[model samples]
Target: MKSTDIFLEILGCPSEEMHEPVNAGYICPYTSDRCSKRGHGTNDPFPVCSIWKYTGARENRRKDRPVIVCPKRFYTADIVGDILEHVWVGPYERNKINAVREIKMGKIGNVDMVVCDTSNLPALDNFVSVELQAIDITGTVSDVYTSHLSQTDLIRSPKYNFNTANVHKRYLTQLIKKGYFHSTWRKKIVAVIQDVLFESIRERVRFAATNPKDENTSIVFMSYTLDPTETDEEGYYRLKLKEVVGTEHSVLMNAVVYETPPSKDLFVAAIKRQL
Candidate 1:
């Protein structure tokens, strides 16, 4: 089916076949901006809302424009599957989370959806276990990251959160500490520390959390390489971090760090890399 049709379905709204605009189908003249906002205050007859505006944008825009919607069914299943099947990597998930706020303020980005899951979280005793399980799976990295850290307060405010407890150096210091995860960089590298130096992975992961409630929440991170030939084994997938921003401190930060691996094929060479 067409993407618009799918989007309408995911939203649980009537398709155009209903022969009426979404606003027409509902009672009261709810403008697109007055219906979709999250959270609430004293009920207003019509305070500008977030959800209403988004849905209205979809339902009220020019029909002749190129279809910007993904197949609606994409929303029904786990987001990780869709990411692997579609969407390019690099800050896409982070961008989606940020875009939500932008939408509320009438600012928009290319991000289409925001995802969350609880399996990607790191435990105080077994952070590597979470990381290994995540590496083994093939779904949306953002979903997996959210799942693992579901219990952590960081998820509440991704914009400001990191694995490290400190906010001032949340992104940069922690990035250096994680070795970029699966990367080959030197100098207490952050992300690849799990793969490169397993002994301190726990400390590094925690150091990256911006506001770690328990020792289990992970600061969302990923790794990638610019060399097309670097491949998975060579540590091409870069690390990224995510959390909600403003309300509680979660913020998705992608700093585009550069790292030169000691060896090109580091992560791939480990036969027993499994968690």
Candidate 2:
């Protein structure tokens, strides 16, 4: 099936264009275009406005510059969630897809996305944690620096070094803190990364999956490529999951228990000085 079909099935197409007459005394926040109505309304949750389109088009016209503002930026998370639901969960699993954007787990800080079963009361069981990273990994150092020093700098910067130890550390930290490694329920962590970035860290991912300190947890890596040539009817770039790799111990890693530290606040003080 065409990639567009998958997107359409999961997200549905954008709502048809609204042709409602503008209310009197209405002004466009973006372009200052006067409207016949006081407010604007559209059936589509994500309505395409002329301002965004024009800006994106203008940015794309610059051959030497990076196109930072595009439709893919907005729908990437939704697309990933849909792909996970269809490809990983499938119809047989009695699971509900939940996309938690920035949930905090102890010291691990904010996690990207998490999918879990809704039928189960305790949402931690039978879940998958996904981290999505989308960036142009092919740009030369100079090109990247010119576009935005902050964009790809994390991958090579001395402090962040995103591709090397940081990726594994962050992923493992999230898995451990989320109880994915310690829970007695089925749990998996998937990292959805761009193809170029995935290649740079494929070795690390393999090593981590192969030699997980905690034998009970498994990590899966899925790489996606955006086809510059292929776009949907809406002119949005098409994305394809190029590859998926998981460790041989994936099955064995299920339902293993890992101990967690005691909460200091929950326990009584060791000594009472002067009650």
Candidate 3:
């Protein structure tokens, strides 16, 4: 099936019902932590499975407000590792893959996750740095709309869309810096993002693919969503990851050199105050 059709089908389905436990023997794919029956927003110490929580509550409500929770936490590194093992890399070789979470690289900061082929250890080329970015889907509607208008009217706009601008600054920029640091190693970086930032992400990818640059970087974009039809024993939605854009060498190379303004301190501080 077409990627667009899959995206629409997943989005149209109710988030809570997307993944339902077929039997009592199914296991939670996210983590090994024991699953609890407590609903979200309670003070219960036991952690509930993410699939059991309501991911589309904002969509169902009349307020149109953004969900404050981070979606990345729901789809943790282990889950990402499983997806990469079974889907991107063949399951036969999945045993060779090792996933490490929150590993700090010198100067580049703590990356969300890193996947490496254990058989090829000490070879940086075998390592893939993964970054997870989940933006507030409903919160930046006005900004996204404005960005679309500017694009259609041929107006000069900012380098990144307001909604995902921070993601570019915080995550993608760090990947570029790491690429320069490990230029000889030729490590690959993958950025996994939610589908809500699709248009903004495509714009960034198009700009990068068309532009010429000197950095020999390899980056990939993986878009993920909850599977509408299946779930685990914990009744959490299954995740589906797809390569949406920027898997080409030309795109990755140019994308790494895209100019990023050093306004993170100010921007982050402002956002924190608002929160």
Q: Clashes per prediction?
A: 69, 8, 2
Regions more than 4 Å wrong, model 1? 1-11, 14-78, 85-275
In Å, residue 29's CA in model 1 sits off its true spot by 20
lDDT of 3 by residue, 1-275 (tens): 11121112111122222222323222333433333333234333212122111233334622221221244344532444544643243232567877787898876587777877676557634566777766532222223223322333323322211346666556555655654554446555666665545455566644443111123445556666545467545554455554444444444446546545569999999999999
In candidate 2, residue 3 scores what lDDT?
18
Which candidate leads the pack in lDDT?
A: 3
> In candidate 2, which residue ranges exceed 4 Å CA deviation?
1-95, 121-124, 135-185, 203-217, 248-275
Lowest summed-lDDT stretch of 10 residues in model 3?
A: 1-10
Better of 1 and 2 by TM-score: 2
TM-score of each: 0.18, 0.44, 0.50
Tell me, by TM-score, which candidate is best.
3
Writing each residue's lDDT as its tens digit, candidate 2 over 79-179 gives 44544543354343434555556566556565566666566566444456666543321212232222221222223321111232454445445544544
Which residue window of length 10 is worst by lDDT in model 1? Answer: 129-138
Q: Where in model 3 is the C-alpha error above 4 Å?
A: 1-71, 74-92, 120-125, 136-162, 208-217, 227-230, 247-275
